[model samples]
Target: MLETLLTHVASAAEATGETTEASGDIMSSLGIDWQMLAFQIIGFALIVFLLGKFVFPILLRSIDERNAKIEEGLKAAREAEDNATKAQSKIDDQLAEARREAKEIVATAKDEATAMLSKADEKAKQNAKHVLDQAHDEISKEVIAAKKALHNETLELVASATERVIGKTHSAKADKAVIAEALKGADK
Candidate 1:
Protein backbone atom coordinates (compact mmCIF):
# COMPACT_ATOMS: atom_id res chain seq x y z
CA MET A 1 0.00 0.00 0.00
CA LEU A 2 2.78 2.45 0.86
CA GLU A 3 4.61 1.55 -2.34
CA THR A 4 1.49 2.14 -4.40
CA LEU A 5 0.98 5.53 -2.81
CA LEU A 6 4.66 6.40 -3.33
CA THR A 7 4.47 5.42 -7.04
CA HIS A 8 1.38 7.58 -7.55
CA VAL A 9 3.15 10.54 -5.90
CA ALA A 10 6.21 9.96 -8.16
CA SER A 11 4.20 9.88 -11.42
CA ALA A 12 2.28 12.96 -10.52
CA ALA A 13 5.57 14.72 -9.73
CA GLU A 14 6.99 13.60 -13.15
CA ALA A 15 3.94 14.91 -15.04
CA THR A 16 4.38 18.24 -13.32
CA GLY A 17 8.09 18.25 -14.35
CA GLU A 18 9.21 18.20 -10.65
CA THR A 19 12.64 16.60 -10.25
CA THR A 20 13.49 13.67 -7.91
CA GLU A 21 15.12 16.18 -5.57
CA ALA A 22 11.78 18.11 -5.32
CA SER A 23 9.94 14.84 -4.69
CA GLY A 24 12.39 13.97 -1.90
CA ASP A 25 11.81 17.50 -0.50
CA ILE A 26 8.04 16.89 -0.63
CA MET A 27 8.46 13.54 1.12
CA SER A 28 10.67 15.14 3.70
CA SER A 29 8.08 17.90 4.22
CA LEU A 30 5.38 15.25 4.69
CA GLY A 31 7.69 13.29 6.99
CA ILE A 32 6.86 10.01 5.21
CA ASP A 33 9.26 7.01 5.01
CA TRP A 34 7.81 3.63 4.05
CA GLN A 35 10.56 1.27 5.28
CA MET A 36 11.21 3.14 8.56
CA LEU A 37 7.46 3.50 9.34
CA ALA A 38 6.91 -0.17 8.65
CA PHE A 39 9.84 -1.15 10.85
CA GLN A 40 8.59 1.14 13.66
CA ILE A 41 5.04 -0.31 13.48
CA ILE A 42 6.40 -3.88 13.50
CA GLY A 43 8.66 -3.10 16.45
CA PHE A 44 5.83 -1.46 18.36
CA ALA A 45 3.51 -4.47 17.68
CA LEU A 46 6.25 -6.92 18.83
CA ILE A 47 6.89 -4.94 22.00
CA VAL A 48 3.13 -4.85 22.78
CA PHE A 49 2.89 -8.63 22.15
CA LEU A 50 5.94 -9.40 24.36
CA LEU A 51 4.68 -7.21 27.20
CA GLY A 52 1.18 -8.74 27.04
CA LYS A 53 2.48 -12.34 26.81
CA PHE A 54 5.24 -12.28 29.47
CA VAL A 55 6.08 -8.98 31.21
CA PHE A 56 2.48 -7.76 31.87
CA PRO A 57 1.26 -11.07 33.37
CA ILE A 58 4.33 -11.37 35.60
CA LEU A 59 4.05 -7.76 36.77
CA LEU A 60 0.31 -8.10 37.38
CA ARG A 61 0.79 -11.36 39.31
CA SER A 62 3.51 -9.76 41.44
CA ILE A 63 1.23 -6.76 42.15
CA ASP A 64 -1.64 -9.09 43.06
CA GLU A 65 0.61 -11.11 45.37
CA ARG A 66 1.91 -7.96 47.00
CA ASN A 67 -1.66 -6.73 47.55
CA ALA A 68 -2.66 -10.11 49.03
CA LYS A 69 0.32 -10.05 51.40
CA ILE A 70 -0.56 -6.51 52.46
CA GLU A 71 -4.16 -7.56 53.09
CA GLU A 72 -3.00 -10.55 55.16
CA GLY A 73 -0.70 -8.34 57.17
CA LEU A 74 -3.57 -5.93 57.79
CA LYS A 75 -5.82 -8.79 58.88
CA ALA A 76 -3.19 -10.11 61.28
CA ALA A 77 -2.63 -6.66 62.70
CA ARG A 78 -6.36 -6.22 63.28
CA GLU A 79 -6.56 -9.60 65.05
CA ALA A 80 -3.59 -8.69 67.24
CA GLU A 81 -5.17 -5.38 68.10
CA ASP A 82 -8.41 -7.13 69.01
CA ASN A 83 -6.54 -9.63 71.13
CA ALA A 84 -4.69 -6.83 72.90
CA THR A 85 -7.96 -5.10 73.56
CA LYS A 86 -9.45 -8.28 74.99
CA ALA A 87 -6.42 -8.82 77.19
CA GLN A 88 -6.60 -5.29 78.45
CA SER A 89 -10.28 -5.70 79.18
CA LYS A 90 -9.60 -8.93 81.05
CA ILE A 91 -6.87 -7.27 83.06
CA ASP A 92 -9.15 -4.40 83.90
CA ASP A 93 -11.86 -6.80 84.99
CA GLN A 94 -9.43 -8.69 87.16
CA LEU A 95 -8.23 -5.49 88.73
CA ALA A 96 -11.78 -4.48 89.42
CA GLU A 97 -12.51 -7.85 90.96
CA ALA A 98 -9.42 -7.62 93.13
CA ARG A 99 -10.41 -4.19 94.28
CA ARG A 100 -13.89 -5.38 95.09
CA GLU A 101 -12.53 -8.33 97.01
CA ALA A 102 -10.18 -6.07 98.94
CA LYS A 103 -13.04 -3.78 99.79
CA GLU A 104 -15.12 -6.71 100.94
CA ILE A 105 -12.28 -7.97 103.11
CA VAL A 106 -11.85 -4.57 104.66
CA ALA A 107 -15.56 -4.32 105.34
CA THR A 108 -15.59 -7.77 106.90
CA ALA A 109 -12.64 -6.86 109.03
CA LYS A 110 -14.38 -3.74 110.20
CA ASP A 111 -17.49 -5.68 111.04
CA GLU A 112 -15.50 -8.30 112.91
CA ALA A 113 -13.65 -5.64 114.83
CA THR A 114 -16.86 -3.96 115.79
CA ALA A 115 -18.29 -7.26 116.93
CA MET A 116 -15.20 -8.02 118.98
CA LEU A 117 -15.31 -4.62 120.54
CA SER A 118 -18.94 -5.10 121.46
CA LYS A 119 -18.17 -8.45 123.08
CA ALA A 120 -15.29 -6.96 125.00
CA ASP A 121 -17.42 -4.12 126.24
CA GLU A 122 -20.13 -6.50 127.40
CA LYS A 123 -17.59 -8.70 129.19
CA ALA A 124 -16.08 -5.67 130.91
CA LYS A 125 -19.51 -4.58 132.14
CA GLN A 126 -20.25 -8.05 133.49
CA ASN A 127 -16.92 -8.20 135.33
CA ALA A 128 -17.49 -4.75 136.81
CA LYS A 129 -20.93 -5.74 138.05
CA HIS A 130 -19.56 -8.92 139.62
CA VAL A 131 -16.82 -7.00 141.40
CA LEU A 132 -19.30 -4.44 142.71
CA ASP A 133 -21.58 -7.18 144.04
CA GLN A 134 -18.64 -8.83 145.81
CA ALA A 135 -17.63 -5.53 147.38
CA HIS A 136 -21.17 -4.95 148.69
CA ASP A 137 -21.29 -8.43 150.23
CA GLU A 138 -17.93 -7.87 151.93
CA ILE A 139 -19.08 -4.51 153.32
CA SER A 140 -22.28 -6.08 154.68
CA LYS A 141 -20.38 -8.86 156.39
CA GLU A 142 -17.95 -6.41 158.00
CA VAL A 143 -20.79 -4.20 159.31
CA ILE A 144 -22.57 -7.19 160.90
CA ALA A 145 -19.35 -8.36 162.58
CA ALA A 146 -18.67 -4.85 163.97
CA LYS A 147 -22.20 -4.63 165.39
CA LYS A 148 -21.84 -8.03 167.13
CA ALA A 149 -18.50 -7.01 168.65
CA LEU A 150 -20.01 -3.77 170.05
CA HIS A 151 -22.90 -5.72 171.61
CA ASN A 152 -20.54 -8.17 173.32
CA GLU A 153 -18.42 -5.35 174.76
CA THR A 154 -21.52 -3.59 176.15
CA LEU A 155 -22.68 -6.77 177.89
CA GLU A 156 -19.33 -7.26 179.57
CA LEU A 157 -19.22 -3.63 180.80
CA VAL A 158 -22.79 -3.86 182.23
CA ALA A 159 -22.01 -7.09 184.15
CA SER A 160 -18.84 -5.61 185.65
CA ALA A 161 -20.65 -2.40 186.78
CA THR A 162 -23.45 -4.40 188.45
CA GLU A 163 -20.94 -6.53 190.34
CA ARG A 164 -19.11 -3.39 191.59
CA VAL A 165 -22.36 -1.63 192.73
CA ILE A 166 -23.58 -4.64 194.74
CA GLY A 167 -20.13 -5.07 196.35
CA LYS A 168 -20.26 -8.76 195.41
CA THR A 169 -19.54 -10.93 192.32
CA HIS A 170 -22.52 -12.76 190.75
CA SER A 171 -22.51 -16.35 189.48
CA ALA A 172 -22.25 -16.94 185.75
CA LYS A 173 -25.92 -17.87 185.32
CA ALA A 174 -27.07 -14.90 187.50
CA ASP A 175 -24.84 -12.46 185.53
CA LYS A 176 -26.24 -13.59 182.26
CA ALA A 177 -29.84 -13.24 183.60
CA VAL A 178 -29.14 -9.77 185.01
CA ILE A 179 -27.50 -8.61 181.79
CA ALA A 180 -30.39 -9.93 179.76
CA GLU A 181 -32.91 -8.12 182.00
CA ALA A 182 -30.90 -4.87 181.73
CA LEU A 183 -30.70 -5.16 177.95
CA LYS A 184 -34.45 -5.80 177.74
CA GLY A 185 -35.18 -2.74 179.90
CA ALA A 186 -32.86 -0.58 177.73
CA ASP A 187 -34.76 -1.75 174.65
CA LYS A 188 -38.07 -0.69 176.27
Candidate 2:
Protein backbone atom coordinates (compact mmCIF):
# COMPACT_ATOMS: atom_id res chain seq x y z
CA MET A 1 0.00 0.00 0.00
CA LEU A 2 2.88 2.43 0.83
CA GLU A 3 4.68 1.54 -2.42
CA THR A 4 1.64 2.47 -4.50
CA LEU A 5 1.25 5.72 -2.56
CA LEU A 6 4.91 6.59 -3.17
CA THR A 7 4.62 5.78 -6.87
CA HIS A 8 1.58 8.02 -7.22
CA VAL A 9 3.32 10.89 -5.37
CA ALA A 10 6.49 10.48 -7.54
CA SER A 11 4.40 10.57 -10.74
CA ALA A 12 2.66 13.66 -9.58
CA ALA A 13 6.00 15.33 -8.79
CA GLU A 14 7.37 14.29 -12.27
CA ALA A 15 4.35 15.85 -13.94
CA THR A 16 4.91 19.06 -12.02
CA GLY A 17 8.73 19.04 -12.73
CA GLU A 18 9.41 20.22 -9.16
CA THR A 19 11.13 17.04 -7.69
CA THR A 20 14.87 16.96 -6.58
CA GLU A 21 17.17 14.43 -4.82
CA ALA A 22 17.06 16.49 -1.57
CA SER A 23 13.23 16.27 -1.64
CA GLY A 24 12.43 12.58 -1.41
CA ASP A 25 8.85 11.33 -1.48
CA ILE A 26 8.48 11.29 2.31
CA MET A 27 10.57 14.43 3.00
CA SER A 28 8.69 16.42 0.32
CA SER A 29 5.39 15.19 1.71
CA LEU A 30 6.39 16.60 5.07
CA GLY A 31 7.69 19.79 3.37
CA ILE A 32 11.25 19.21 4.63
CA ASP A 33 14.43 19.94 2.60
CA TRP A 34 17.38 17.71 3.75
CA GLN A 35 20.19 20.19 3.10
CA MET A 36 18.38 23.01 4.92
CA LEU A 37 17.54 20.67 7.86
CA ALA A 38 21.16 19.63 8.13
CA PHE A 39 22.25 23.28 8.19
CA GLN A 40 19.73 24.15 10.95
CA ILE A 41 20.85 21.17 13.11
CA ILE A 42 24.51 22.20 12.75
CA GLY A 43 23.66 25.79 13.66
CA PHE A 44 21.77 24.74 16.81
CA ALA A 45 24.62 22.41 17.94
CA LEU A 46 27.20 25.21 17.40
CA ILE A 47 25.14 27.60 19.52
CA VAL A 48 24.85 25.06 22.38
CA PHE A 49 28.60 24.30 22.24
CA LEU A 50 29.53 28.00 22.37
CA LEU A 51 27.25 28.69 25.34
CA GLY A 52 28.57 25.63 27.21
CA LYS A 53 32.23 26.64 26.66
CA PHE A 54 32.02 30.35 27.51
CA VAL A 55 28.74 31.90 28.80
CA PHE A 56 27.59 28.89 30.91
CA PRO A 57 30.95 28.57 32.74
CA ILE A 58 31.03 32.27 33.57
CA LEU A 59 27.44 32.22 34.82
CA LEU A 60 28.03 29.05 36.87
CA ARG A 61 31.23 30.51 38.44
CA SER A 62 29.39 33.67 39.40
CA ILE A 63 26.61 31.63 41.03
CA ASP A 64 29.16 29.51 42.92
CA GLU A 65 30.98 32.63 44.17
CA ARG A 66 27.70 34.10 45.39
CA ASN A 67 26.89 30.89 47.27
CA ALA A 68 30.35 30.91 48.94
CA LYS A 69 29.86 34.53 50.04
CA ILE A 70 26.48 33.70 51.56
CA GLU A 71 27.96 30.76 53.46
CA GLU A 72 30.81 32.87 54.81
CA GLY A 73 28.43 35.55 55.99
CA LEU A 74 26.31 32.98 57.79
CA LYS A 75 29.38 31.50 59.49
CA ALA A 76 30.50 34.92 60.69
CA ALA A 77 27.06 35.67 62.14
CA ARG A 78 26.97 32.36 63.99
CA GLU A 79 30.43 32.97 65.44
CA ALA A 80 29.39 36.41 66.63
CA GLU A 81 26.34 34.95 68.36
CA ASP A 82 28.46 32.30 70.05
CA ASN A 83 30.95 34.89 71.25
CA ALA A 84 28.13 36.98 72.66
CA THR A 85 26.77 33.99 74.53
CA LYS A 86 30.16 33.23 75.99
CA ALA A 87 30.64 36.82 77.09
CA GLN A 88 27.24 36.84 78.76
CA SER A 89 28.07 33.60 80.56
CA LYS A 90 31.30 35.07 81.84
CA ILE A 91 29.52 38.17 83.06
CA ASP A 92 26.95 36.08 84.90
CA ASP A 93 29.66 34.01 86.57
CA GLN A 94 31.49 37.13 87.66
CA LEU A 95 28.31 38.58 89.12
CA ALA A 96 27.64 35.41 91.06
CA GLU A 97 31.17 35.33 92.41
CA ALA A 98 30.98 38.96 93.41
CA ARG A 99 27.73 38.38 95.25
CA ARG A 100 29.19 35.41 97.07
CA GLU A 101 32.22 37.41 98.10
CA ALA A 102 30.06 40.25 99.29
CA LYS A 103 28.02 37.89 101.43
CA GLU A 104 31.16 36.44 102.94
CA ILE A 105 32.48 39.89 103.73
CA VAL A 106 29.23 40.90 105.33
CA ALA A 107 29.11 37.74 107.42
CA THR A 108 32.69 38.24 108.53
CA ALA A 109 32.00 41.83 109.45
CA LYS A 110 28.94 40.83 111.44
CA ASP A 111 30.86 38.17 113.29
CA GLU A 112 33.61 40.58 114.15
CA ALA A 113 31.12 43.15 115.37
CA THR A 114 29.40 40.58 117.56
CA ALA A 115 32.68 39.49 119.09
CA MET A 116 33.73 43.05 119.81
CA LEU A 117 30.43 43.86 121.46
CA SER A 118 30.60 40.78 123.66
CA LYS A 119 34.10 41.63 124.79
CA ALA A 120 33.14 45.21 125.57
CA ASP A 121 30.09 44.10 127.54
CA GLU A 122 32.15 41.63 129.58
CA LYS A 123 34.74 44.29 130.32
CA ALA A 124 32.06 46.74 131.49
CA LYS A 125 30.52 44.13 133.81
CA GLN A 126 33.93 43.35 135.33
CA ASN A 127 34.58 47.05 135.94
CA ALA A 128 31.17 47.52 137.58
CA LYS A 129 31.73 44.55 139.88
CA HIS A 130 35.13 45.85 140.89
CA VAL A 131 33.71 49.29 141.70
CA LEU A 132 30.92 47.74 143.81
CA ASP A 133 33.36 45.57 145.72
CA GLN A 134 35.61 48.58 146.44
CA ALA A 135 32.68 50.65 147.70
CA HIS A 136 31.58 47.82 150.07
CA ASP A 137 35.12 47.47 151.47
CA GLU A 138 35.34 51.23 152.11
CA ILE A 139 31.99 51.24 153.92
CA SER A 140 33.07 48.30 156.14
CA LYS A 141 36.29 50.07 157.10
CA GLU A 142 34.42 53.28 158.06
CA VAL A 143 31.95 51.36 160.26
CA ILE A 144 34.79 49.58 162.13
CA ALA A 145 36.55 52.93 162.77
CA ALA A 146 33.33 54.51 164.11
CA LYS A 147 32.76 51.53 166.48
CA LYS A 148 36.26 51.87 167.95
CA ALA A 149 35.71 55.57 168.60
CA LEU A 150 32.39 54.96 170.38
CA HIS A 151 33.93 52.26 172.63
CA ASN A 152 36.77 54.60 173.63
CA GLU A 153 34.34 57.42 174.52
CA THR A 154 32.11 55.09 176.63
CA LEU A 155 35.15 53.80 178.59
CA GLU A 156 36.21 57.38 179.46
CA LEU A 157 32.72 58.29 180.65
CA VAL A 158 32.49 55.22 182.93
CA ALA A 159 35.93 55.91 184.44
CA SER A 160 34.83 59.48 185.46
CA ALA A 161 31.53 58.26 186.98
CA THR A 162 33.25 55.59 189.07
CA GLU A 163 35.67 58.19 190.49
CA ARG A 164 32.76 60.42 191.59
CA VAL A 165 30.97 57.49 193.38
CA ILE A 166 34.02 56.41 195.39
CA GLY A 167 34.42 59.93 197.02
CA LYS A 168 38.16 59.32 196.79
CA THR A 169 40.52 59.74 193.80
CA HIS A 170 41.71 56.38 192.63
CA SER A 171 44.45 55.93 190.07
CA ALA A 172 43.12 56.94 186.60
CA LYS A 173 44.72 53.87 184.88
CA ALA A 174 43.13 51.46 187.41
CA ASP A 175 39.64 52.90 186.93
CA LYS A 176 39.91 52.71 183.13
CA ALA A 177 40.98 49.06 183.28
CA VAL A 178 37.93 48.22 185.50
CA ILE A 179 35.51 49.93 183.06
CA ALA A 180 36.97 48.02 180.09
CA GLU A 181 36.46 44.72 182.04
CA ALA A 182 32.78 45.58 182.82
CA LEU A 183 31.92 46.46 179.20
CA LYS A 184 33.73 43.49 177.66
CA GLY A 185 30.73 41.79 175.94
CA ALA A 186 28.38 44.88 175.89
CA ASP A 187 30.31 47.12 173.51
CA LYS A 188 30.35 44.56 170.68
Candidate 3:
Protein backbone atom coordinates (compact mmCIF):
# COMPACT_ATOMS: atom_id res chain seq x y z
CA MET A 1 0.00 0.00 0.00
CA LEU A 2 2.85 2.37 0.77
CA GLU A 3 4.62 1.52 -2.49
CA THR A 4 1.40 2.16 -4.45
CA LEU A 5 0.95 5.56 -2.76
CA LEU A 6 4.58 6.53 -3.44
CA THR A 7 4.28 5.59 -7.13
CA HIS A 8 1.13 7.67 -7.45
CA VAL A 9 2.84 10.62 -5.82
CA ALA A 10 5.83 10.31 -8.13
CA SER A 11 3.67 10.08 -11.17
CA ALA A 12 1.66 13.13 -10.15
CA ALA A 13 4.86 15.10 -9.45
CA GLU A 14 6.24 14.20 -12.87
CA ALA A 15 3.02 15.17 -14.54
CA THR A 16 3.19 18.55 -12.80
CA GLY A 17 6.89 19.04 -13.72
CA GLU A 18 8.17 18.98 -10.05
CA THR A 19 11.63 17.49 -10.33
CA THR A 20 12.96 18.58 -6.85
CA GLU A 21 11.49 18.08 -3.37
CA ALA A 22 12.56 21.35 -1.70
CA SER A 23 10.61 23.19 0.96
CA GLY A 24 12.37 26.54 0.25
CA ASP A 25 11.38 26.53 -3.44
CA ILE A 26 7.78 25.72 -2.51
CA MET A 27 7.69 28.51 0.06
CA SER A 28 9.33 31.00 -2.28
CA SER A 29 6.91 30.17 -5.14
CA LEU A 30 3.98 30.89 -2.79
CA GLY A 31 5.63 34.19 -1.76
CA ILE A 32 5.70 33.17 1.93
CA ASP A 33 8.68 32.66 4.30
CA TRP A 34 7.93 30.08 6.97
CA GLN A 35 9.47 32.28 9.71
CA MET A 36 7.44 35.34 8.59
CA LEU A 37 4.24 33.22 8.44
CA ALA A 38 4.82 32.04 11.96
CA PHE A 39 5.31 35.69 13.19
CA GLN A 40 2.16 36.88 11.35
CA ILE A 41 0.12 34.02 12.89
CA ILE A 42 1.44 34.97 16.34
CA GLY A 43 0.45 38.62 15.80
CA PHE A 44 -3.08 37.53 14.75
CA ALA A 45 -3.37 35.36 17.81
CA LEU A 46 -2.32 38.30 20.07
CA ILE A 47 -4.86 40.58 18.44
CA VAL A 48 -7.62 37.95 19.02
CA PHE A 49 -6.56 37.60 22.63
CA LEU A 50 -6.68 41.38 23.23
CA LEU A 51 -10.11 41.61 21.64
CA GLY A 52 -11.34 38.70 23.77
CA LYS A 53 -10.04 40.39 26.95
CA PHE A 54 -11.34 43.93 26.31
CA VAL A 55 -13.87 44.31 23.46
CA PHE A 56 -15.44 40.83 23.83
CA PRO A 57 -15.82 41.36 27.58
CA ILE A 58 -17.75 44.59 26.86
CA LEU A 59 -20.06 42.64 24.52
CA LEU A 60 -20.57 39.91 27.12
CA ARG A 61 -21.32 42.53 29.78
CA SER A 62 -23.94 44.14 27.51
CA ILE A 63 -25.58 40.72 27.00
CA ASP A 64 -25.60 40.13 30.77
CA GLU A 65 -27.11 43.59 31.41
CA ARG A 66 -29.86 42.91 28.84
CA ASN A 67 -30.64 39.59 30.53
CA ALA A 68 -30.74 41.30 33.95
CA LYS A 69 -33.14 43.94 32.63
CA ILE A 70 -35.43 41.21 31.30
CA GLU A 71 -35.33 39.47 34.68
CA GLU A 72 -36.12 42.72 36.52
CA GLY A 73 -39.09 43.36 34.22
CA LEU A 74 -40.43 39.88 34.96
CA LYS A 75 -40.05 40.44 38.70
CA ALA A 76 -41.87 43.76 38.50
CA ALA A 77 -44.70 42.11 36.57
CA ARG A 78 -45.00 39.41 39.25
CA GLU A 79 -45.07 42.04 41.99
CA ALA A 80 -47.80 43.94 40.14
CA GLU A 81 -49.84 40.74 39.86
CA ASP A 82 -49.45 40.17 43.59
CA ASN A 83 -50.58 43.71 44.32
CA ALA A 84 -53.60 43.24 42.09
CA THR A 85 -54.50 40.06 43.92
CA LYS A 86 -54.28 41.85 47.27
CA ALA A 87 -56.45 44.70 46.01
CA GLN A 88 -59.06 42.25 44.77
CA SER A 89 -59.08 40.52 48.12
CA LYS A 90 -59.56 43.80 49.91
CA ILE A 91 -62.46 44.71 47.65
CA ASP A 92 -64.06 41.35 48.21
CA ASP A 93 -63.67 41.72 51.94
CA GLN A 94 -65.28 45.14 51.80
CA LEU A 95 -68.16 43.75 49.79
CA ALA A 96 -68.67 40.95 52.27
CA GLU A 97 -68.60 43.37 55.15
CA ALA A 98 -71.07 45.62 53.44
CA ARG A 99 -73.40 42.70 52.83
CA ARG A 100 -73.20 41.71 56.46
CA GLU A 101 -73.96 45.24 57.56
CA ALA A 102 -76.91 45.42 55.24
CA LYS A 103 -78.26 42.18 56.61
CA GLU A 104 -77.91 43.47 60.13
CA ILE A 105 -79.72 46.66 59.25
CA VAL A 106 -82.53 44.69 57.63
CA ALA A 107 -82.83 42.47 60.66
CA THR A 108 -82.96 45.45 62.97
CA ALA A 109 -85.69 47.04 60.88
CA LYS A 110 -87.70 43.83 60.92
CA ASP A 111 -87.40 43.63 64.69
CA GLU A 112 -88.57 47.19 65.08
CA ALA A 113 -91.53 46.60 62.80
CA THR A 114 -92.48 43.51 64.72
CA ALA A 115 -92.30 45.38 67.99
CA MET A 116 -94.46 48.19 66.62
CA LEU A 117 -97.08 45.72 65.38
CA SER A 118 -97.12 43.97 68.72
CA LYS A 119 -97.59 47.27 70.54
CA ALA A 120 -100.41 48.27 68.20
CA ASP A 121 -102.15 44.95 68.77
CA GLU A 122 -101.82 45.35 72.53
CA LYS A 123 -103.30 48.82 72.38
CA ALA A 124 -106.19 47.63 70.24
CA LYS A 125 -106.98 44.85 72.68
CA GLN A 126 -106.91 47.27 75.61
CA ASN A 127 -109.22 49.70 73.83
CA ALA A 128 -111.63 46.87 73.01
CA LYS A 129 -111.63 45.76 76.65
CA HIS A 130 -112.33 49.30 77.86
CA VAL A 131 -115.21 49.74 75.40
CA LEU A 132 -116.69 46.38 76.38
CA ASP A 133 -116.51 47.22 80.08
CA GLN A 134 -118.19 50.60 79.51
CA ALA A 135 -120.94 49.02 77.38
CA HIS A 136 -121.63 46.30 79.98
CA ASP A 137 -121.88 48.88 82.78
CA GLU A 138 -124.21 51.10 80.74
CA ILE A 139 -126.43 48.09 79.86
CA SER A 140 -126.71 47.10 83.55
CA LYS A 141 -127.70 50.63 84.55
CA GLU A 142 -130.30 50.87 81.78
CA VAL A 143 -131.82 47.50 82.75
CA ILE A 144 -132.22 48.66 86.36
CA ALA A 145 -133.83 51.94 85.26
CA ALA A 146 -136.25 50.07 83.01
CA LYS A 147 -137.22 47.78 85.82
CA LYS A 148 -138.02 50.71 88.13
CA ALA A 149 -140.13 52.45 85.47
CA LEU A 150 -142.04 49.20 84.82
CA HIS A 151 -142.73 48.75 88.51
CA ASN A 152 -144.06 52.26 88.88
CA GLU A 153 -146.27 51.89 85.84
CA THR A 154 -147.63 48.51 87.10
CA LEU A 155 -148.55 50.06 90.48
CA GLU A 156 -150.36 52.96 88.77
CA LEU A 157 -152.29 50.49 86.55
CA VAL A 158 -153.34 48.39 89.57
CA ALA A 159 -154.54 51.45 91.50
CA SER A 160 -156.62 52.59 88.50
CA ALA A 161 -158.12 49.12 88.11
CA THR A 162 -159.17 49.02 91.82
CA GLU A 163 -160.72 52.50 91.54
CA ARG A 164 -162.71 51.45 88.50
CA VAL A 165 -163.89 48.23 90.16
CA ILE A 166 -164.93 49.68 93.64
CA GLY A 167 -165.27 53.42 92.86
CA LYS A 168 -162.66 54.54 95.48
CA THR A 169 -159.24 56.27 95.40
CA HIS A 170 -156.04 54.64 96.72
CA SER A 171 -154.74 55.69 100.13
CA ALA A 172 -151.61 57.88 100.38
CA LYS A 173 -149.93 55.29 102.59
CA ALA A 174 -150.43 52.55 99.99
CA ASP A 175 -149.11 54.79 97.22
CA LYS A 176 -146.02 55.54 99.28
CA ALA A 177 -145.47 51.82 99.84
CA VAL A 178 -145.73 51.08 96.11
CA ILE A 179 -143.21 53.80 95.24
CA ALA A 180 -140.80 52.44 97.91
CA GLU A 181 -141.07 48.92 96.53
CA ALA A 182 -140.31 50.17 93.00
CA LEU A 183 -137.22 52.01 94.32
CA LYS A 184 -136.07 48.84 96.17
CA GLY A 185 -136.38 46.77 92.99
CA ALA A 186 -134.36 49.38 91.15
CA ASP A 187 -131.57 49.05 93.77
CA LYS A 188 -131.45 45.28 93.31
Best by TM-score: 1
**TM per model?**
0.60, 0.51, 0.51
Q: How far is candidate 1 from the true structure (C-alpha RMSD, Å)?
A: 8.7
Off by over 4 Å in 2: 1-66, 156-188
- Would you list the clashing residue pairs of candidate 2? none
Per-residue alpha-carbon lDDT of model 1 for 17-55, expressed as tens digits?
Answer: 444455667777899754455556755876798899999
Candidate 3 local accuracy as lDDT? Answer: 0.83
**Per-model tally of clashing residue pairs:** 0, 0, 0
Q: Residue 15 deviation, candidate 1, in Å? A: 23
Worst 10 residues of 2 by lDDT: 14-23
lDDT of 2: 0.82
Question: What tens-digit string does per-residue lDDT give for candidate 2 at 75-180?
Answer: 9999999999999999999999999999999999999999999999999999999999999999999899999999999998899787687657666888798889
Query: Residue 68 lDDT in model 3?
Result: 96
Q: What TM value does model 3 have?
A: 0.51
For model 3, residues 28-105, the per-residue Cα lDDT tens digits are 898876555554565577678878988999998999999999999999999999999999999999999999999999
Alpha carbon deviation, residue 172, candidate 2 (Å): 16
**Model 2, residue 39: what's the lDDT?**
49
Best-matching candidate per lDDT:
1
- Could you tell me the C-alpha RMSD of candidate 3 in Å? 13.4
